[model samples]
Target: MDNTTTEDTSDTEEEILVYAEFADSVNIEKYNSMHILGIDTKTPIVQMNETFFTGTYENPLGTYMFFENDTSPQSTDPVFDRIPEKNVKYVCKTRKLLKVEHGYITPKDGSGQSTQNQAQQAQEDAIKMVSFKTVQEALDKFKQEWCTNESSSTDNNINNLKES
Candidate 1:
Protein backbone atom coordinates (compact mmCIF):
# COMPACT_ATOMS: atom_id res chain seq x y z
CA MET A 1 0.00 0.00 0.00
CA ASP A 2 1.35 3.46 -1.01
CA ASN A 3 0.50 6.30 1.44
CA THR A 4 0.73 9.89 0.15
CA THR A 5 -0.73 13.19 1.40
CA THR A 6 -2.11 15.23 -1.48
CA GLU A 7 -1.92 19.04 -1.10
CA ASP A 8 -5.21 20.85 -1.85
CA THR A 9 -4.71 24.34 -3.29
CA SER A 10 -8.12 24.72 -4.93
CA ASP A 11 -10.20 24.76 -1.76
CA THR A 12 -7.79 26.82 0.33
CA GLU A 13 -7.85 30.62 0.25
CA GLU A 14 -5.08 32.77 1.73
CA GLU A 15 -6.08 35.90 3.67
CA ILE A 16 -3.75 38.87 3.66
CA LEU A 17 -3.91 41.79 6.18
CA VAL A 18 -2.01 44.88 5.24
CA TYR A 19 -1.18 47.63 7.74
CA ALA A 20 0.66 50.89 7.09
CA GLU A 21 1.93 53.83 9.13
CA PHE A 22 0.29 57.06 8.15
CA ALA A 23 1.68 60.52 8.81
CA ASP A 24 1.78 63.89 7.11
CA SER A 25 5.33 63.06 6.23
CA VAL A 26 5.21 59.56 4.83
CA ASN A 27 8.02 57.45 3.54
CA ILE A 28 7.97 57.90 -0.24
CA GLU A 29 8.58 54.19 -0.63
CA LYS A 30 5.50 53.35 1.46
CA TYR A 31 3.49 56.07 -0.28
CA ASN A 32 4.18 54.53 -3.68
CA SER A 33 2.96 51.11 -2.55
CA MET A 34 -0.35 52.44 -1.14
CA HIS A 35 -0.84 54.65 -4.20
CA ILE A 36 -0.72 51.56 -6.38
CA LEU A 37 -3.63 50.12 -4.38
CA GLY A 38 -5.94 53.08 -5.26
CA ILE A 39 -6.87 54.29 -1.77
CA ASP A 40 -8.40 57.73 -1.48
CA THR A 41 -5.85 60.39 -0.52
CA LYS A 42 -8.04 62.36 1.90
CA THR A 43 -9.41 59.33 3.72
CA PRO A 44 -7.77 58.73 7.06
CA ILE A 45 -5.17 56.03 7.28
CA VAL A 46 -5.36 56.01 11.08
CA GLN A 47 -7.42 57.78 13.70
CA MET A 48 -7.98 57.79 17.44
CA ASN A 49 -11.07 59.94 17.41
CA GLU A 50 -9.46 63.43 17.10
CA THR A 51 -6.19 62.34 18.60
CA PHE A 52 -4.65 61.15 15.36
CA PHE A 53 -5.42 62.34 11.86
CA THR A 54 -4.92 60.26 8.77
CA GLY A 55 -5.56 60.94 5.11
CA THR A 56 -4.02 60.82 1.70
CA TYR A 57 -2.29 63.13 -0.76
CA GLU A 58 -3.52 63.13 -4.32
CA ASN A 59 -1.05 63.73 -7.12
CA PRO A 60 -1.03 63.05 -10.82
CA LEU A 61 0.31 59.56 -10.19
CA GLY A 62 -2.05 58.31 -7.44
CA THR A 63 -3.27 58.67 -3.87
CA TYR A 64 -1.11 58.01 -0.84
CA MET A 65 -2.56 57.56 2.65
CA PHE A 66 -1.08 59.64 5.46
CA PHE A 67 -1.20 60.25 9.17
CA GLU A 68 -0.96 63.74 10.57
CA ASN A 69 2.21 64.02 12.59
CA ASP A 70 2.85 66.64 15.25
CA THR A 71 3.56 69.07 12.45
CA SER A 72 0.33 68.36 10.62
CA PRO A 73 -2.99 70.16 10.84
CA GLN A 74 -4.45 70.08 14.33
CA SER A 75 -7.63 70.89 16.22
CA THR A 76 -5.91 74.12 17.16
CA ASP A 77 -5.13 74.66 13.53
CA PRO A 78 -6.56 77.58 11.53
CA VAL A 79 -9.62 75.59 10.52
CA PHE A 80 -10.42 75.23 14.19
CA ASP A 81 -9.78 78.96 14.56
CA ARG A 82 -13.12 79.37 12.86
CA ILE A 83 -14.93 78.39 16.07
CA PRO A 84 -13.44 81.17 18.15
CA GLU A 85 -13.80 83.64 15.33
CA LYS A 86 -17.42 82.72 14.96
CA ASN A 87 -17.92 82.98 18.67
CA VAL A 88 -16.30 86.38 18.68
CA LYS A 89 -18.46 87.54 15.83
CA TYR A 90 -21.56 86.18 17.53
CA VAL A 91 -20.86 87.24 21.11
CA CYS A 92 -18.13 89.81 21.51
CA LYS A 93 -17.68 91.64 18.25
CA THR A 94 -19.26 94.98 17.46
CA ARG A 95 -19.41 95.86 13.80
CA LYS A 96 -20.23 99.10 12.00
CA LEU A 97 -21.35 97.49 8.77
CA LEU A 98 -23.19 94.61 10.39
CA LYS A 99 -24.91 96.88 12.84
CA VAL A 100 -25.91 99.63 10.44
CA GLU A 101 -26.41 97.69 7.25
CA HIS A 102 -27.68 94.24 8.14
CA GLY A 103 -28.67 94.91 11.77
CA TYR A 104 -27.14 91.61 12.74
CA ILE A 105 -25.57 93.02 15.89
CA THR A 106 -26.52 96.12 17.83
CA PRO A 107 -24.05 98.95 18.34
CA LYS A 108 -23.11 97.95 21.86
CA ASP A 109 -20.29 96.30 23.75
CA GLY A 110 -21.19 93.03 22.00
CA SER A 111 -20.08 91.09 25.04
CA GLY A 112 -21.85 88.17 26.69
CA GLN A 113 -24.40 90.68 27.90
CA SER A 114 -25.07 91.77 24.33
CA THR A 115 -25.29 88.21 23.20
CA GLN A 116 -27.97 87.48 25.79
CA ASN A 117 -29.83 90.64 24.94
CA GLN A 118 -29.62 89.91 21.24
CA ALA A 119 -30.83 86.38 21.84
CA GLN A 120 -33.82 87.62 23.79
CA GLN A 121 -34.38 90.23 21.13
CA ALA A 122 -34.19 87.53 18.49
CA GLN A 123 -36.80 85.48 20.30
CA GLU A 124 -39.03 88.52 20.49
CA ASP A 125 -38.25 89.35 16.90
CA ALA A 126 -39.07 85.85 15.78
CA ILE A 127 -42.35 85.99 17.61
CA LYS A 128 -43.13 89.34 16.02
CA MET A 129 -41.83 88.33 12.62
CA VAL A 130 -43.89 85.17 12.52
CA SER A 131 -47.53 86.01 11.80
CA PHE A 132 -49.80 83.07 12.38
CA LYS A 133 -52.80 82.81 10.10
CA THR A 134 -53.32 79.48 11.84
CA VAL A 135 -52.01 77.75 14.99
CA GLN A 136 -50.38 75.08 12.84
CA GLU A 137 -48.61 77.75 10.86
CA ALA A 138 -47.28 79.36 14.02
CA LEU A 139 -46.11 76.03 15.35
CA ASP A 140 -44.38 75.17 12.11
CA LYS A 141 -42.76 78.58 11.93
CA PHE A 142 -41.53 78.32 15.49
CA LYS A 143 -40.09 74.87 14.85
CA GLN A 144 -38.29 76.01 11.76
CA GLU A 145 -37.04 79.25 13.28
CA TRP A 146 -35.73 78.11 16.65
CA CYS A 147 -34.77 74.47 16.18
CA THR A 148 -31.35 75.19 14.71
CA ASN A 149 -30.57 78.01 17.13
CA GLU A 150 -31.59 75.98 20.17
CA SER A 151 -29.50 72.98 19.23
CA SER A 152 -26.55 75.08 18.17
CA SER A 153 -26.71 77.16 21.33
CA THR A 154 -26.52 74.03 23.43
CA ASP A 155 -23.70 72.67 21.33
CA ASN A 156 -21.79 75.94 21.49
CA ASN A 157 -22.20 76.03 25.24
CA ILE A 158 -20.97 72.49 25.57
CA ASN A 159 -18.07 73.11 23.22
CA ASN A 160 -17.05 76.22 25.13
CA LEU A 161 -17.20 74.34 28.41
CA LYS A 162 -15.13 71.47 27.08
CA GLU A 163 -11.64 71.18 28.58
CA SER A 164 -9.96 70.52 25.29
Candidate 2:
Protein backbone atom coordinates (compact mmCIF):
# COMPACT_ATOMS: atom_id res chain seq x y z
CA MET A 1 0.00 0.00 0.00
CA ASP A 2 2.80 2.47 0.88
CA ASN A 3 4.66 1.60 -2.40
CA THR A 4 1.56 2.43 -4.47
CA THR A 5 1.12 5.81 -2.67
CA THR A 6 4.81 6.73 -3.21
CA GLU A 7 4.58 6.04 -6.96
CA ASP A 8 1.50 8.26 -7.36
CA THR A 9 3.13 11.21 -5.50
CA SER A 10 6.34 10.87 -7.52
CA ASP A 11 4.38 10.98 -10.80
CA THR A 12 2.68 14.27 -9.83
CA GLU A 13 5.96 15.88 -8.73
CA GLU A 14 7.71 14.92 -12.03
CA GLU A 15 4.91 16.54 -14.07
CA ILE A 16 5.29 19.92 -12.32
CA LEU A 17 9.09 20.27 -12.30
CA VAL A 18 10.30 22.42 -15.29
CA TYR A 19 13.95 23.38 -15.81
CA ALA A 20 15.21 25.98 -18.30
CA GLU A 21 17.96 28.49 -18.92
CA PHE A 22 18.82 31.50 -21.10
CA ALA A 23 20.89 29.53 -23.57
CA ASP A 24 22.84 30.52 -26.64
CA SER A 25 22.29 27.00 -27.97
CA VAL A 26 21.11 23.61 -26.76
CA ASN A 27 24.47 22.16 -27.81
CA ILE A 28 27.36 21.19 -25.52
CA GLU A 29 27.83 24.97 -25.03
CA LYS A 30 24.24 25.56 -23.91
CA TYR A 31 25.63 26.76 -20.53
CA ASN A 32 26.76 29.91 -22.40
CA SER A 33 24.25 32.72 -21.65
CA MET A 34 21.92 34.65 -23.93
CA HIS A 35 19.24 37.37 -23.54
CA ILE A 36 17.20 37.05 -20.31
CA LEU A 37 13.41 37.38 -20.00
CA GLY A 38 12.05 37.63 -16.47
CA ILE A 39 8.61 36.26 -15.80
CA ASP A 40 5.87 38.29 -14.12
CA THR A 41 7.56 38.45 -10.75
CA LYS A 42 5.22 41.18 -9.48
CA THR A 43 2.11 38.97 -9.78
CA PRO A 44 2.79 35.24 -9.68
CA ILE A 45 0.71 32.92 -11.84
CA VAL A 46 -2.27 31.84 -9.69
CA GLN A 47 -1.81 28.10 -10.24
CA MET A 48 1.92 27.41 -10.91
CA ASN A 49 3.27 30.26 -8.69
CA GLU A 50 6.66 29.76 -10.38
CA THR A 51 8.77 32.76 -11.44
CA PHE A 52 10.05 31.90 -14.94
CA PHE A 53 12.70 34.16 -16.37
CA THR A 54 13.58 34.80 -20.00
CA GLY A 55 16.68 36.31 -21.63
CA THR A 56 20.18 36.18 -20.15
CA TYR A 57 20.86 36.02 -16.43
CA GLU A 58 22.71 39.35 -16.71
CA ASN A 59 19.85 41.16 -18.44
CA PRO A 60 16.55 39.69 -17.27
CA LEU A 61 13.78 41.49 -19.21
CA GLY A 62 10.14 40.52 -19.77
CA THR A 63 9.94 41.91 -23.31
CA TYR A 64 10.09 38.32 -24.53
CA MET A 65 8.79 35.09 -22.99
CA PHE A 66 9.95 31.52 -22.83
CA PHE A 67 8.48 28.04 -22.82
CA GLU A 68 9.64 24.50 -22.05
CA ASN A 69 12.46 22.81 -23.99
CA ASP A 70 10.22 20.36 -25.84
CA THR A 71 7.01 22.46 -25.89
CA SER A 72 6.88 25.07 -28.70
CA PRO A 73 4.70 28.15 -28.61
CA GLN A 74 2.37 27.78 -31.55
CA SER A 75 -0.60 29.59 -33.04
CA THR A 76 -2.80 26.69 -32.01
CA ASP A 77 -2.07 26.89 -28.26
CA PRO A 78 -4.96 28.53 -26.32
CA VAL A 79 -4.56 31.64 -24.17
CA PHE A 80 -3.91 31.48 -20.39
CA ASP A 81 -2.46 28.01 -20.90
CA ARG A 82 0.83 26.15 -21.38
CA ILE A 83 2.74 26.09 -24.69
CA PRO A 84 5.92 24.30 -25.76
CA GLU A 85 9.45 25.61 -26.40
CA LYS A 86 10.51 23.67 -29.49
CA ASN A 87 12.93 26.23 -31.03
CA VAL A 88 14.71 27.32 -27.80
CA LYS A 89 17.98 25.94 -29.12
CA TYR A 90 17.29 26.96 -32.71
CA VAL A 91 17.45 30.70 -31.91
CA CYS A 92 21.02 31.91 -32.34
CA LYS A 93 22.07 35.61 -31.80
CA THR A 94 23.37 35.11 -35.06
CA ARG A 95 19.64 34.84 -34.26
CA LYS A 96 16.34 35.86 -35.91
CA LEU A 97 17.73 35.40 -39.40
CA LEU A 98 15.53 37.34 -41.89
CA LYS A 99 16.89 35.77 -45.03
CA VAL A 100 19.93 34.05 -46.50
CA GLU A 101 21.12 35.25 -49.92
CA HIS A 102 23.32 32.75 -51.73
CA GLY A 103 25.58 33.49 -54.68
CA TYR A 104 23.99 32.37 -57.95
CA ILE A 105 25.73 30.55 -60.76
CA THR A 106 26.84 32.82 -63.61
CA PRO A 107 25.62 32.11 -67.16
CA LYS A 108 28.21 30.80 -69.65
CA ASP A 109 28.03 33.93 -71.78
CA GLY A 110 31.00 34.72 -74.05
CA SER A 111 31.83 37.86 -71.98
CA GLY A 112 31.81 35.87 -68.74
CA GLN A 113 34.92 33.68 -69.06
CA SER A 114 37.90 33.14 -66.74
CA THR A 115 40.30 36.10 -66.98
CA GLN A 116 43.17 33.76 -67.96
CA ASN A 117 41.26 32.42 -70.97
CA GLN A 118 42.29 33.79 -74.37
CA ALA A 119 38.72 33.28 -75.60
CA GLN A 120 35.38 32.48 -73.98
CA GLN A 121 35.44 28.98 -75.50
CA ALA A 122 34.87 25.99 -73.22
CA GLN A 123 38.68 25.30 -73.10
CA GLU A 124 41.60 27.58 -72.15
CA ASP A 125 44.21 28.44 -74.77
CA ALA A 126 47.63 26.76 -74.35
CA ILE A 127 50.44 29.13 -73.34
CA LYS A 128 53.94 29.31 -74.77
CA MET A 129 56.18 26.84 -72.89
CA VAL A 130 59.89 27.52 -72.17
CA SER A 131 62.35 24.62 -71.77
CA PHE A 132 64.18 24.23 -68.43
CA LYS A 133 67.63 24.08 -70.23
CA THR A 134 67.01 27.47 -71.92
CA VAL A 135 65.98 29.08 -68.60
CA GLN A 136 69.11 27.71 -66.85
CA GLU A 137 71.39 29.11 -69.57
CA ALA A 138 69.77 32.58 -69.24
CA LEU A 139 70.23 32.45 -65.45
CA ASP A 140 73.90 31.35 -65.82
CA LYS A 141 74.64 34.23 -68.20
CA PHE A 142 73.29 36.75 -65.70
CA LYS A 143 75.23 35.15 -62.78
CA GLN A 144 78.56 35.14 -64.72
CA GLU A 145 78.32 38.79 -65.84
CA TRP A 146 80.25 41.34 -63.71
CA CYS A 147 78.09 44.43 -63.21
CA THR A 148 80.64 47.26 -62.97
CA ASN A 149 79.78 50.88 -62.32
CA GLU A 150 80.43 53.11 -65.40
CA SER A 151 82.91 55.23 -63.34
CA SER A 152 84.33 58.19 -65.36
CA SER A 153 88.08 57.56 -64.81
CA THR A 154 90.95 57.45 -67.30
CA ASP A 155 93.42 55.34 -65.21
CA ASN A 156 95.12 52.64 -67.30
CA ASN A 157 96.77 49.76 -65.38
CA ILE A 158 99.99 48.46 -67.11
CA ASN A 159 98.89 49.90 -70.54
CA ASN A 160 99.56 46.52 -72.09
CA LEU A 161 100.85 43.27 -70.60
CA LYS A 162 104.53 42.94 -71.54
CA GLU A 163 106.27 39.52 -71.87
CA SER A 164 108.11 40.24 -68.53
Each model's total of backbone clashes: 5, 12
Tell me model 1's lDDT, rounded to 2 decimals: 0.42
Regions of candidate 2 where Cα sits further than 4 Å from its true position? 1-99, 111-140, 143-164
Judge candidate 1 at residue 95 and give its lDDT.
17
**lDDT of candidate 2 at residue 17, scale 0 to 100:** 21
Q: Candidate 2 at residue 78, lDDT?
A: 77
lDDT for 107 (candidate 2):
60
Candidate 1 regions with alpha-carbon error over 4 angstroms: 1-41, 47-51, 60-164
* Residue 138 lDDT (model 1): 68
